[model samples]
Structure formats: structure tokens, C-alpha cells
Target chain A: MRNKEKTYNEIVQTAYVMFSEKGFDQTSLSSIASEIGISKPAIYYYFKSKDELIKYLFDKIVQEIQSLTSVELETITTTNFKQNLYQLGEAAISHQEKDVHFNHLFNQYMLLASRDTYYSERLLKIQQDFLNTFYDLLTYAVKINAIKDENILIKSQLLALVFDNITNFILTDMKLDYKKIWIEAVDSVLSGVEHHEQ
Target chain B: MRNKEKTYNEIVQTAYVMFSEKGFDQTSLSSIASEIGISKPAIYYYFKSKDELIKYLFDKIVQEIQSLTSVELETITTTNFKQNLYQLGEAAISHQEKDVHFNHLFNQYMLLASRDTYYSERLLKIQQDFLNTFYDLLTYAVKINAIKDENILIKSQLLALVFDNITNFILTDMKLDYKKIWIEAVDSVLSGVEHHEQ
Candidate 1:
């Protein structure tokens, strides 16, 4: 990485940690800068303000999620669609488990987004894109007679919502066998559709 | 109300507004007292600290939920089980809708619980209680041949989690017709069970 890019990443990384630990309202740019042993002015070069820094972090999070699921989401054969969904759940959990605090941070950012119109719109757009992906996949499943055509819109929304809630379950109860639980949960939702056909 | 009870209620009510508006971390007892036109010492006389006050608030929130769902939860006939669940979701949403900020405040409290062991246990117990209620209903459904007896535990857990997530969807997107969405979501999950039995 170039020197500027490296400095920019350092600032973002430090801010992410501080925001999660102390919370968005309590963590200031100066505190983040001091934590990195840098002057406030240096961070200002990379991020004009704390809000800008947070927006950048949100984009980075979106990019991480996209990269994680892009391969499975793009390759949607009828035979492998259920497997892809299961893999998506597994990938999300394994990635979050590796990071440990990512889900908590993501939720914290969500609360911030919920309060701010600009951030809310940004977050909602990404969520809608995801919902659209699931909707299209379900539409295809219906085409193949994999699922009944009933309530396709709501089922897709429910699946997307469940994906988020499963991540939240990990946050609330670390003892939960979330990967196993998530796979089973997805299986039931998908296979339940197959049962519906009969 | 009695004089002491009235004062206590005032303190709690003021704190709830301030906490939702400014967040838990940013809201102070002194500020709450000031907002209520009470002296700091008077506030201390009722609650020892902000932490104690927060615990009191948590209890109040739990009681509110219990009151809202107690009747539906207690009278769960096999025939009315799904109907009861639908009613519970409706009751929850309508109550939160009445308060406007209640869902946001609840989510804020959840974040606090996620970080603290004491609060996490308190929150988890209530979640477990709700899950058990749903689990029993599903087991009864299985016994009656209303549904298949597969994955009862996870289904109950998923149902409880979806309840939380549906409220969250309202938080993130107020434009959502959450009451309709929630009822339909529950119906599919329950009706999908019947499909499984077929």
C-alpha cells in the first residue's frame, strides 16, 4: 500500500476499535488520534470529520459483506441454491466469529444509522439490494417449482431478516452453537418450501 | 397515586425520555432530575445511582411486556395457538407504536445488555422464557398433528428471534407495515409446519 493509503487504513482501524469499545457518542477523533500516537491533524487529512470516518467504515463493512457472499449469490443453479444459502450463513458466521466484535460494532452502527437520515438511507439501500437478491432467487425457485408461488415477497424478507437476527443471537448468547443452529434454521425454511409443494 | 409513587414514576418517566433522546451513556441522573424539576438529592433519595435507575427501568420494561402478552400466553389452546402468537405480535407492535420511541429504547437497552454480564443474563432469561412458551406451543401442535415434530427447539428459538427482528425492522424502516408483516411472518412459519406434516 502507498504511504497515504496505509495511514488512512490505520486511522479507520483505530476508530473502529474505539467506537466499539467506548461507543460512537463517547469516542472522539482526538482520542482515536492519540490512541494511534498521531496528531489530530493527521486524521483530518484522511477524514474531514468523525462522521466522514464512520461513513467510510460503513462502506468498508458493506464491501466486506459483498465480497463474502458475491460468489455464492452470483452462482445460483437450482440444484445448488439451497447449498449456496447454507454456505452464505456459514460464511457470515465464520467471518463474524473470527472478528468476535464485528456483530456488536455492526449493530452499533445500525443504531446510529437508525437515528440519522443520511446513514439510514445508505444502510436501507444496501439492505434492499440484499432483499432483492433473495427475492430473485426465490422467484427462480418458484419457476423451477422448488417453492410454491405464495408469499414470495414476504418469505424473502423473512429470510433476510433472519440472517440479521442470527448474527444478533451470537451477540446475545455466545454459548449458542450458532453455525449449527443457523444451518438448521435455513434448511427448515427452504425445505419447508419443498414440503409446501406436496 | 401515592405521593412517593408519583415522584418515583416522574423520575422514571423523565429518564426514559432523556435516555431515548440522548442515549444511555449521555443521559445523566442529574440531567433527569433537572428535567423533572427535582433536586439532585431528591433523585438520589429514590435511586442510588444511574446504574440502579437503569435496572429499575429494565424491570419496568419487562413488566410492561408481561402485561401486554400475559393473557395471550397463558391461554394457549392448541386450536388458538397460532392465533395467540399472532395476537402477541400485534400487541407488542401496537404497544411500541403507542410509545413511538419504545422500540428504539428497547434496542438501546439491548446493546447495553450485550455489553454487561448482569444485564445480559436478565435479558436472556426473558428471551428464554418467551422461547419456552413458543416451544411448548409447537410441541402441542406436533402432538395434535397440527404440525410435524421436527426441529421444535430451533423453531421456537427462530420464532422468538423473528419477533425481536420484526420489531427491529420497524426501527430501521418505519415505512414498513410491521403489524401486517409480523402477522404474515408468523402465519407462514406456523402454516409451514403444517406443510411439513403433509
Candidate 2:
């Protein structure tokens, strides 16, 4: 059982790198096994196929991300709401930066989500969770009079889109100051932009 | 020459629906050929393989979109810049609504672009073109004294992110009023948001 667990981790880690670099269709079970110095049967003992391997990776990543950044509802106050929310987005970006080739994994997942109903549903759940988090914060902001006149529901959804899309700049290899872009948009939307009619 | 052109269009149109519905990997050349009521060899006569067919489809779609929406810079001004820019975004959304299964097709392309240097480079050119359009309009806004901003380039890039992310809500089947969302963000950023500090 112990050895089997080690082998499982190896296969999944290898699949993550391969799938990130090569995509799902092009990456084969044989290549994964070869990279890990194991036979195809060894990978099969844990994951039945490439689809199964990817599914496992997806579920595990989701779980890890959720647990790592789960927030307590009772803890958020008006004063800290913006900071807390910003922290959450930062945590997500940092996790991607530190560990898994998260941007590539996410780009790969977008392809899968478009075709596979399973992935589509899985992604929706994660997005809904994030949207709700933004909604709750925006609701709190409205309560304290931080932002006004905006439909919180639509605003939340839009903010979620804005936040989620920040990571996409990485894929193009463009020399983008992503931090500035991310901060400017998120801050202005949440705290309300200081604007004037000239 | 005419028959060859007809055959090429037939293969591309058929591939479009299959690739959107079934994804690039699952949509085999045999499947596309059979669906088009043509033999496998006929598909090869126009294209080499599934990869070549997809590349051709991608290039064709990019060219079609570019030609369909090429903008004239001479007409934009301070007063009409916001509306003109808003119109550009609407054109993109409506084009997706009318012709291409754009959300699905774009999702598929993201996956392909992540791994394939060729597709990645191709997409960058398209994106750069779009980015330049946004930058140009924003620069015009600044010159005409419409938008007051510290960094036009970064603001333009961030605005592009905000606008581009709007289409993403479609993929989840969420009943979002995307046009409203798109316009609100663009307008606020372009025409300074009406702000009152308490």
C-alpha cells in the first residue's frame, strides 16, 4: 500500500508537467510511464488511463486550492474586507507561481471544460465559489458605504471575470507588469475609482 | 481549382462543428471526412492531417475575423471615443453570437495555444492587434482630454483584460447580461466614473 501510494504521486506529478507542456491529447500513457521509470501497467494500477489521470489531478488541485485558501465567514469585517479579498487573490496567484505550472494547467483545463461536461461542471463550482466570495465582500462594502449604486450581483460576477483573467497574460510570454494591472483593476472596482468629469 | 476550393470549404465547415462539439483531439480526420460524405483520401488532397486541418481552420477564422472588423483610426474622437470603443466590443460579441461557436472555439484554441508554439505565436499576433486598437483609442482619449490617467499603456492593457474577460462568462452557461457588463466596465474606465466621496 505504501509503495503504491508513492507510485501514484510520481505518475500524477509527471502527468502534470507533461500535460502542462504537451496538452492532454498529445501526452500518452506510455510517455508518462517512461518518464517515471515505470511500466505502463504500473501507472494503470493506479490510474486506468490518461483521462483518469487528468481527472485525479484536477480533483486534487481543486481540493488543495480550496483548503489552502478557505476563509472563515465570521472573521471578515468592513475594515479588512478589501485586504482579505486581495489576499485571497494573491494566495491563488502565488500558489500557481510556486508549485504546479498552474497557468498552463488552467489553460489546458479550459480546453477540457469546453468538451467534457465533467470538467465544465467542476469549473463552474469553483467559479461560483469565487463569485460568491466576491459577492459577500461587495455586499459588506455596500453596507459600510464603500461602494454604491452598482448592482452587487452583476458587479461581483464582473469582478470575478476581471480577477480570473489576470493570469491569462502569462501564457503569451509578453513582458507585462501583471501585478500593476491586477492591482489597478481590482482596487478601482472594489474600492470605487476616484473619477472626475473634466 | 474551383473543386479544390469547394472541397476546402466543405472540410473546414464540417471540422468547425465537430471541433466545437467534440474537441480537436476527438474530431478525427476520418470522422470529419465521413461526416462530409467524402473519403479519407479526399481530406488529404486538401490537407495533410488533423493538425494541418486545424491550423488551416484557425488561420482562416483569424483572417475572417480580422477582415470582418478592421477599424479605421481616422474617425475616432474625444466625444465619440467611448461609444466607438464600446461599439467595437459589441461587434466582437455579436459576431460570436451570429457566426462562430466562438466560446467553444476559443476554449479549444486556448488549449492548443498553450502547448503549440505555432498556435501560441499566431494567437499573440491576433491579441497584439486587438491590444493595439485599445491602446490607440485610449491614447486618443488622453490626447483629446477625455481620459485622465497616469499610465496609458498599462491602463489600456488592463482595460483590454477587463473587456476580454467579459466573454468568459458565456462558457459556463450562466445567464449573464454580458453586454451590460462589458459596457459598464469600458464606460467607467473611459469616461471617468462619477465619484462622490463621503
Candidate 3:
């Protein structure tokens, strides 16, 4: 069992590198097996086909990203909402800084999403989860009488869009101070809610 | 001369259809020529290769999009700033509504941008132009005493990010009332500057 799992991991890792370099369509299972010194049949034992391999790889990538930067409700407080968001932005920046090829991988994934329902659903889930995090933060702020907003849904959705946009820029390797940009952008949106008494 | 121009246009239009349906990498000059009932060398006479064809196509796409939805400085008034923005958002929504394959072509172009400097520079120009439009709008608003903010640069950047994000969602075929969302999101960000006198 240990040997089987090791081979599976090696195949996945090799495939990731190849896909990132050559893109999903251009990379082949034969190429991955040759790169890993594994038999082609061995990969089939792990993943039925290239499609299955990509799906599995995508799920793993999303899980890694979620663990790295997703908001934790328990760590946030009503009064320090802006501070907590700043931390979220910082985590995002660090993730990008650590991985130079992440932007290419992400753009490739987005292209896949445009073609496949499975990828599009995954993309939507990420967007939905981001919006939900904002909804929870806003709810906590309202519960503590820290802010006022009649359109929480739209506000959270907008915040999620703004956050995703900035992150997209960071992922695309744009030469900008993303952390500063995120803070300034968040401040502009949050300021409207920050001072409202009712 | 007229026949030459007609054949050139046919090749471009046919390539556009094939590329939109099958993506850039999967589509080929031979396939495009066959589709248009022309010889492969005829396409070569107009475009040197697939790379050259794609570059030309991308340029045309950008030009078309710019003409469709880009903000016109002459159409704006300092007093009705938000209304002018709303009109801009409306033009964006209408553009998406008109073309279903635009999002896929855009995703393909973005994927190309990741691997090629030419595409990335084009993408940057679009983003920079968007940011500049916001700067112009905000400058006008401030000149007429319609809004006030010390961080116009950051504000314009954030607004551009938000606008681009919302348009991305629309292009990706997200089922939502985008115009309503655009208005609400813009309202939240703009409200911060609208009420501040200094």
C-alpha cells in the first residue's frame, strides 16, 4: 500500500510540472510517464485518463489554496474586522510570492473552466465561498452594532468580486503592490459601512 | 485587388469561427482554409503562420471590444457622475449579452497571454486604459465638487478592479443580475468619496 501511494504521488507531481509548462491540452500521459520513469499502465491504475488526472490535480490545488488563505471565523472579531481582512490579504500575497508558476497554472485552470462544466462549477464554488465568508463577517459586525448595511448580500458579493479581482492580478504576475492595493481598495469599500450608525 | 481583400476577410472570419469553437491551439490554418473552400497557401499569403493569424485576431478582438464598451470622455458630466458610470456598466452588459463565444475567446486569449509576451502586453494595455478612464472620471468629479477623496489613484484602481471582476463574471456566463450588482457595488465604493467634502 505504501509503495502504491508513493507511485501515485510521483505521477501526480510529474504531471503537475508538465501541465504547468506545456498546458493541459499539449501535455500527454505518455509524456508524464516518461518524465516519471513509470509505466503508462501504472498511471491508469491511479487515474483512468488524462481528464481524471487533471480533475484530481485541480481538487488538490484548490484544497492547498483554501488551507493557505481562507478566512477562519473563529479568528475574526467584530471590532477588528478590517484588521482581519488585512491579514487575509497578506496571506494571499504570501501565497503568490511563494509560487512563481501559480499564475500560469491558474490561468490554465480558468481556460479549462471555460470549456468544462466541472471546472466552472469549481470556480463558482470558490467565488461563492469567498462571498459567504464576507457575509459571515458582516453578520458578526452587525450583531455587535459595529456597522449598518441594508444590502448585505450585494455588499458581500461585491467585496468577494473585488477581492477575487485583486487576487487575480497578483496571480497574473502584475508588477504592483498588491497588499497596499488590497488594503486601499478594502478601505474604500469598508469605509462606507464602517461609519454608519444605523 | 478587391478579390484579394475579399479572400483575406474570408480567411479571418473563418478562422475566428473555428478558433471560437475549437480554441486557438486546436484550430489550424488548414482547417480554416478547408472551411472557407480556399487553398492552404492562400491563407499563408495573408498570414505568415498560426502565430501571426492569432496576433492579428487578438488585435481585432481588442479593437472591437474597445469600440463597444470603452468609456467616452465627451459623454460624461461632472454633476451626474454615478449615472454616467451606470451607462458604462450598461454598455458592458449589453456587449456580453450580444456575444456568447466572447468569454471563451477571451479565456483562450488569457491562456495565450501567460505563455507569450505579446498577449500579456496587450492585456496590460487594456487594464491600464481602464484605470485611466476611472482617473479621468474621478478628476472631473472632483473638479465640479461632486466628490472628494485624497486617494483618487487608489480609488480609481479599486473601481477598475471591481468593474473588471464583474465583467469577468458576466463573460464566464454566471447567471446573475449583473447590472444590479454593478450599480450596488459602484454605489458602495463611490459613496465613500461622494459624502466626503475634504
Candidate 4:
């Protein structure tokens, strides 16, 4: 039983590297097993197919994002909420920016998610998690009287758009002009979230 | 010669509908030929393969966008700059939004664009065209003293971001919240373009 668990995790680790490097379509289960020195049938016993492996990877990414962002958000003080927000924004973009191959694999999954309902719901869950995270963070600021009673739900969604969409859009092209666009977007979002006196 | 051109155009039109309906992977040359009542070889004579046909359809979409937006942009007088921008934005989004199947095909092409440099350049041209159109319109307002000497380049790019990005994002799901987000984004964009006193 212990050996079985070891082999399962080993397969997951091997498949993640293979999938990120070769992309989902190009990387096969046989290739994954071959790289791990396991039989193809043995790999299938763990992941069923590449589809299941990708689904596991999606969950892993979401968990990683949640944990990583949660750690960052917890450090936000009332005195530096705005500054922290900018820092968090930079961190999020840079996190994805640093990993080119993983970005490619991640992007391909986004395209596939639209075509498959199972993936679509998984994507929706990731989006909902992000929105909820941002909402709760801002709500904390509001509760502590650090910020005004802002319409945070809308702000969160729009800010997520600014964060995720711009980050995703500028993934491939990181020219100065593109970076300017991204920074301009995040700055605009930060300012927009401020409680303006009407 | 005239008859040959007519047949070619008819094939193009038929393939567009079929490709959008069935997606590129599922839609084959034989299927297109059967739908158009032409021999498979004749279709192949015009287009080497599905790749050429897809390329042709992309060019056709670009032409349609230019003609469509040119007519809209020409009507933007100084008095109605903001409202006209709204109208133009809505027009562009609704134009693509009207055809659901085409959005799938168009989005598939976008995914492909990231993988293939040739398609990437074509997609970049579309983005540049949109930016140029917005830049020209905003520049007109600036030249005529309708607005301040705004950073038209950044404004144009950001507004184009709001226009095209939001337009593309809302293609799949036009829920009430999504519409609100789109309007929220555009409104923020318009307000952000204003010359703020330092």
C-alpha cells in the first residue's frame, strides 16, 4: 500500500513536468511512464489518462494560488492596504510571467475549458475563489474602518478582470509598451477601488 | 473567369458557416465540399487545405471589422464623443456577439494564434488596427479642442483594451453581472482618460 502511494505521487510529479514542457496534446501517458521508468499500464492505474492528470494539475494550480495569495494577503496592514494591493498585483503577474512553459500549458487549459463542461466548471470555481478572496480581503479593510464601505463585490470582480485578464493577455508579449499597459491597468484598478467622496 | 470567381466566393461563404458551426477540427474539406455541392478536388484546387481556408476566413473577418468600424467611427462628432464611443463600443461587441458560433471559431483561432507565429502576427494586426482606430478617433477630439491633450497613445491603448478585451471576454457569457462589468470597465476607461490636475 505504501509503495502504491509512492508510485502515485511519483507519476503526478513526472506528469506535471512532462505536461508543462510538452503541452497536454503533445505529451502522452506512455511518454510520461517511459520518463518515470514505469510501465504505461502502471501509469494508467494511477491517472486513468492525460485528461485526469490535467484535471489534477488544474486543482493543484488552484490550491497553489490560494495558498500563495492567502499568505500575501494576510500580511496586508491597514496602514498599507493600497501599497500592499499593488505589491500583490505585481506578485501575481510576475508569478505567472516567470514560468513560460507552465503559462503555455495553463493557457491551453483555459481554451479547452470553454469547450468542456467539466473544465468549464473547474475554471468557474477558480474564478469564484479569486473573487471571494479579494472580496474578503477588502471587507476586512472595511470592517476595520481602514477603507470606506465600498462596493467591494463589483470592485473585486473588476479588479480580478484587471488582474487576471491583463496578466493573461500580456503573458506572451512583455514589451515595454505591453508592460506599460499592464501597469496602467493595475494602477487604474487600485485607484478605482478607493472610496471617492461624492 | 467570372464563373470561377463566383464559385470561389461561394465556397468561401459556405466554409465560413460550416467551420463556425462545426469547429475547425470537426469540419473537413470533404464536408465543406459536400455542403457547397462541389467536388472535394475542386475545393482543394482553390484552397490547398483547411489551413488556407481558415486564413482566408480570417482576412474576411478583418475586412468586415474595418468596414464595420469605419462607418461607426466616421459618425463620432465632437459633441457626441463619449456617447459615440459608447455606441461604437456596443456596436463592435454586438457585431461579434450576434454570431455565437463564430465566436467559438474566432476564439479557437485566437488559441491557435498563440501557438503559430504567422497567426500571432495576424492577430496582432487586428489588435493594432483596433488601437489605431481608437487613437485616430481620440486624436480628432484632441485636435479639435473637444478634450485636453490627453496621452492619446495610452488612452487609445487602454480604451482599446477596454473595448476589445471586454468585448472578447463577454462573448461567451453575457450575464447581467458581466454586462455590468463591461459597462463599468468602459465607464472607468472614459473617466480615466480625463486630464486630471496634478
Candidate 5:
């Protein structure tokens, strides 16, 4: 049983890499099985179909991101909201770097989900959860006077978009140092030009 | 000659709709031709291949956006910098709305360009022009004290990302009132948060 579970994870990881490198349409179940040194039948036994494999992988990644957000939010002890928000942004960037497949999978999944109803609901739920977590954090920060209180939904959506763009920019264009640009951008958001009055 | 130009334009427009609706991979030259009431051979006459057709459409869209930005920037008076910047954002959002296929084409083109050197260069140049245009505008706005003076590159990139996200959000999931949200967001950036004075 343990061996079967390990093989299942290994197959998913291999699929992630192949999908990132070749995109969803170009990557195939047969290619994944070949890369994993397993037979087509073995992959079928584990994932049933390519769509199923993609859906499962998408769910797993979303779950992992949610867990990370939850952990970070729960551990905040400092009253400095800028530092806290910076930490969240850094965590997101680090996670994307570690999982190179995250951005590709996200783009692919979103593109596919837009056309197909099967994936849309699942994707929407994941998106809503992400938005809600950020909204809650922003709300908390505002309550504590850590960050300015404003349109929580709009600001949350904007923040999410900023991170998404940063990730997509890095993945699509390899010329720029995305990490440096992202850090600088986040700092600008945290500290505006207005001098704080004592 | 005029008739031929009209037919060619119709073919490209039809192809854009079909490609955005069904995706580039699933769309075919024959489908576009049929949608435009033209023969496959006729489409071949205008665009040697499906790839060429796609490239032409992508370039056309990029050029249109660039021209719009140029026209808007040229009309901006230094005295009304905030209003000018807001108008620019509005123009971008309106342009994006008018070209529903822009996001679809951009996403498809990016994916294809990632694999092809020729298309990749064209795509990069178009993207760079868009970023540079906004960077210049932000720099001007800072010089006029219309907005906060900060890192032009970083601020411009963040603004670009915000606009991209707004477009994506409108295109993908949300059906909210974009005009209101966009105006408010732009205003917030222009007026900025009233910082606690030291």
C-alpha cells in the first residue's frame, strides 16, 4: 500500500515537470509513463486518464498553497503589517520558485477551465478560498491599523493579481530577475511616498 | 481592391473570434474561412499559413494598443496629470473590452511563442513596448508631482500587472462593475492614502 502511494506521488511529480516543460496539450499520459519508467497500464491504474491526473494535480497544488497561507496567517505575532504582508509575498514567491510547475499549471488550468464547465467550479472554489484568505488577512491588518482600511475585496483581488502577474512574468519571460523586481514592487506597496507624521 | 481589403479584414476578424472562442489549438483555417464565408484557398491567399494568420492578428492587436497609448499620451497636458493618467487607464480597459480576443490571443500567442524563436522575439518586442510606454507615463506623472515619485520601473511594472489582472479578472471569472472598480483603484493611486504625518 505504501509502495503504491509512493508511485502515485512519483507519477504526479513527473507529470508536473512534463506539463510545465511541454504544456498541457503537448504533454501526454504515454509520455509521462515513459518518463516515470512505468507502463501505460500502470499510469492508467493510478490516474485513469490524463484529465483525471491533471485535476488531481491541480487539487493537490491548491491544497498545498492554502495550507501555506493558513500556516503563515496563524503564526503572525508582530504588529508590523508591512513586514507581515512582505513575509506573505515572499512566501508566495518562494513557493512558486520551489514549484516551477505552479505557474504553468495555473495558467493552463485557468485557460482550460474557462472553456469547460467540468473544471470551472473546482477552479473557482480554489480561487474563492484564496481570495477569502487574503481578504481576512487584509481585514485583520486594517483592524490592527497595520495597513490602511479600504476596499478589501478590490485590494485583495489586486494583490492576488500582482502575485499572479509576477509569477507569469517570470515563467514567460526569463530575461528579468523576477525575484528582485517582485521584492521591490512589494516594498513600494507597503511603504508609500507619504511621510508618516508622529 | 477595396472589396479585397474588406474580405481580408473580415477573414481576420472571424478567425479572431473563432480562435478566442475555441482556442488556437482547436481552431482551423477552414473554420475561419467558413465563418467568414470565404474558401480555404482564399484564406491561404491572404495568409500563407495558419501560423502566419495568427501572427498577423497578434501583431495587429499589439499595434492597435500601442497606437492608442501614443494618442492618449500625446493629448495629456502636464497640468492635468492625474486626470490624464486616469484617462489612460480607462482607455486601456475600454480597449481591452472592445477587443475581447486580445487576452485569448495573448495567452495563445505566449504559449506558442514559448516554443518558436521567431514568434518569441515578436512577442517580446510587443510586450516590451507596452511596458515601456507605461513606464514613460509614470515617470512623467512623477515629474509633475501628480503621483508619488518612486522607482519608475517597479511602479510601472506593478501598474501594468494591475491592469493585466483587471483585464484577466473581467475576462475570466468576475462579472462585477469594472468601470467603478477601475476608477476607484486609479483614484486611490492618484490621490494616495493620507499618511499619518510625523
Candidate 6:
């Protein structure tokens, strides 16, 4: 059973790389199987179709993100609010970049998912989960008086967008260092919004 | 002469629509001509090829944006920072929606352009123009004491990324109302970063 699960994961990872490089419509199951050095039947046994394969990959990504957030939140319990938020941002960006296939898969997934209703709901749930984490952080900061009280919804949404922009910038290979860029953005957000002692 | 120019403009507009609905690679000159009710030769008369058509369309977009920025900068001499910045963000989002084809062309262009050196220079120039405009705005704001004097390069880059996100969100048909969302984002940047007098 463990061996079967490992093979399934390996196939998904290989499929993600091909899908990102060639696009969904362009990638073929045979090519994926060939790349993985696995038989077509083996892939079919794991995933009924290419669409199902992509969906499974998406689910795994969401699960990984959920786990990452939970772990980070648990570790940051004693840290200052600003440091905690910065760490979260760094972790999210780092995780996305650590695997080249991750950003490509994410961009492709988002572009397709946005247009299709069936996929959009699933995508929205993933987005909401991520946003809820940020919202909780903001709410905590406000409670701790580390940040000013404003509209939490708008604030959370804005922070989410900022992070989105950072991710896109990195994925696009923009001629800027993302680490420096994101760190500065976090500082700007923290300093700009925090209640300053007059 | 005026009639010929109008006809050419109509052809370009029709091509933009078709290209946006059907992606650039998926679109052909024959189809664009058919949509415009013109012969294939007629399209060649206006644009020698599909690449030429894309270049023409991109140049027109850059020109339109440059003109808009110039007009806005000229009119707002007093530097009412927040209002000016808000209006600029509003203009950008509205312009994007009005020229929906620009977004489609841009997305396809990014994928294709990234692989070809021929398109890279033109793409880079467009990006540079955008960055310069944003930097100018940030500089003006800082000079007028509307925003804190900090690293304009990083802030400008972040602002440009936000603008790109707004355009992407609109193109993706995301559920959030862009105008309201942009207003909130701009307000957050302004309010968070400004030196508040207690």
C-alpha cells in the first residue's frame, strides 16, 4: 500500500512538470507515462483520466498549504505579530518557489479554474482557507494592539492581494529579487498600517 | 484618408476581439479577416502578418496609456496625493475593462514573448514605461508629503504588481468588484504609509 501511494505521488509530480511546461491541452497521458517510465495502465490505475490527475494534484497542493499554515501558526505562538506575519509570507513564497513545477501548476490551474464554474468553487474554497488564516493573524494583531483596528475584511483582502502580487512577480521572473521585494512589502504593510505612537 | 484610417482602425478592433476570444496562437489572419468582412488581401494591406498585427496593437495600447498618464499628470499639478493616486488606480482598472482585448493579448503575449528574444525588447520597453510612470507618481507623492519618503523603487514595483493583479483579476472574471477592491487597496497603501499627524 505504501509503495502504491509513493508511485501515485511520483506520477502526479511528473504530470505537474509536464502540464506546467506544455500546458494542459498540449500534455498527453502517454507522454506523462513515458516520462515517468511507467505503463499507461499504471497511470490509469491511479487516475482515471488526465483531468482527474490534475484535480488530484490540486487537492494535494491545498492540503500541503493547510498543513504548512497549521505548522507555522503553531510555531509562531510566542513571536511578535510583525515577525510572525513576515515569517508566514516568507514561508508561502519559499514553498511556492522551491518547486519550479509548483508555480507553473498554480498559474495554469488558476487561469483555467477561474473560467470554469465547477473548478472555481474548489479554488475559492482553497483561497478562503488561505485568507482565513491571514484574517486570523490580523485579528490577533489587532487584539494584541500590534496593529490598528480597521476593517478586517478589507485589510485581509488587501494583504492577500499583496501576497498574490508577490507570487506572480516571482513566477513571471520579473527582474527583481522576490525575497527583498516581499520583505519590503511586509515592512511597508506593517509600518504603514500599524498605529504609530504620536 | 480619414475613411481609410477609420477602416484600418475597425480592422484592428475586430482582430483584437477575435484574438481575445480565441487565443493568439489559436487565431489566424483568415479568421480575423472573415470577422471583419474583409478579404485576406485586405488584412495584409493593413498588417503584413499576424506578428505585425500584434505589434501594432501593442503599440497602440502603450500610446493610449502614455497619453492618459500625461493628461492626468498635467491636470493634477497640486498633488492631492491620495485623491490623485486613487484616481490613477481607478483609471487603470476602468481602462483595462474598457479594453478587454488588451488583457487577453497580454497573457498570450507573456507566454509567447518569454520564449522568443524577438518580442523581449518590445515587452521590456512596455514594462519600463509602466514602471517609470508609477515611480513618477510615488516621487510626486513623497515630495508633497502625501506619502513617506522611503524606497520608491520597491514601492513602485509593488504598486506596479498591484496594478497587474487588478488587470489579471479582471481578465480572470474573478468575483470581486475591481473598482471597490482597488479603491480599498489604494487607500490601504496611502493610509498605512503616510505620516499621520496626531
What tens digits encode model 2's per-residue C-alpha lDDT throughout A19-40?
A: 8887778888899889999998
For candidate 3, write residues A53-119 as lDDT tens digits. Answer: 9888888888876675466666566667778878877877787677756656766777777667888
Model 2 TM-score on a 0 to 1 scale? 0.89
Candidate 6: residue pairs that collide: A192-B192
Ranking by TM-score, best first? 2, 3, 1, 5, 6, 4
DockQ of each: 0.44, 0.54, 0.54, 0.33, 0.38, 0.34
Off by over 4 Å in 6: A1-10, A30-48, A68-79, A192-198, B1-15, B18-78, B99-101, B119-121, B141-148, B171-198
Q: Model 4, range B29-113, lDDT digits (tens) per residue?
A: 8888888788899988888877888898988776776776563555666667777776776776677668755565666666667
Identify the leading candidate in terms of lDDT: 3
Give the CAPRI rating of model 2. Answer: medium
- In model 5, the runs with Cα more than 4 Å from the true position are A1-7, A38-42, A71-74, A174-197, B1-7, B33-46, B71-74, B142-149, B176-198
TM-score of each: 0.83, 0.89, 0.85, 0.76, 0.83, 0.76
lDDT of 4 by residue, A74-129 (tens): 66777777666666667766776676555556655666666677767776666667
> Candidate 6 lDDT, tens digit per residue, A25-129?
667888888888888888989888878998888887777667876524434442366677777678878877787566666666665563566666776777777
lDDT: worst 10-residue window of model 4 chain B: B171-180
For candidate 4, the docking band is: acceptable
Error of 2 at B150 (Å): 2.9
Worst 10 residues of 6 chain A by lDDT: A70-79
TM-score for candidate 1, residues paired by index? 0.83
Preferred candidate (TM-score higher): 1 or 6: 1
| Residues B22-72, model 2: lDDT tens digits | 888888888889998898889888877778888877887788757744667
For candidate 3, lDDT tens digit of each residue in B1-198? Answer: 999999999998888777876788777778898899988999889888888988888888898767755666665666577898887888777877777567568767877777688888888787667678888888877877778856777777777777778777875555667787788767766776785445
Please provide, for model 5 over A1-198, each residue's C-alpha lDDT reduced to its tens digit, 9 standing for 90 to 100.
998998899898899888866787778788888888887889988877888888888887777767866634554543555566667767777777777667776777777776888778877777777767767877766665566665666666656667667767766574655555556544544443223657
- The runs of at least 3 residues in candidate 1 whose Cα sits more than 4 Å from the true structure, single-residue gaps closed, are A1-7, A28-34, A38-46, A66-74, A179-198, B1-7, B28-42, B66-74, B143-148, B177-188, B191-198
TM-score, B chain alone, candidates in order = 0.83, 0.86, 0.87, 0.76, 0.80, 0.82
| Per-chain TM-score of candidate 3, chain B | 0.87
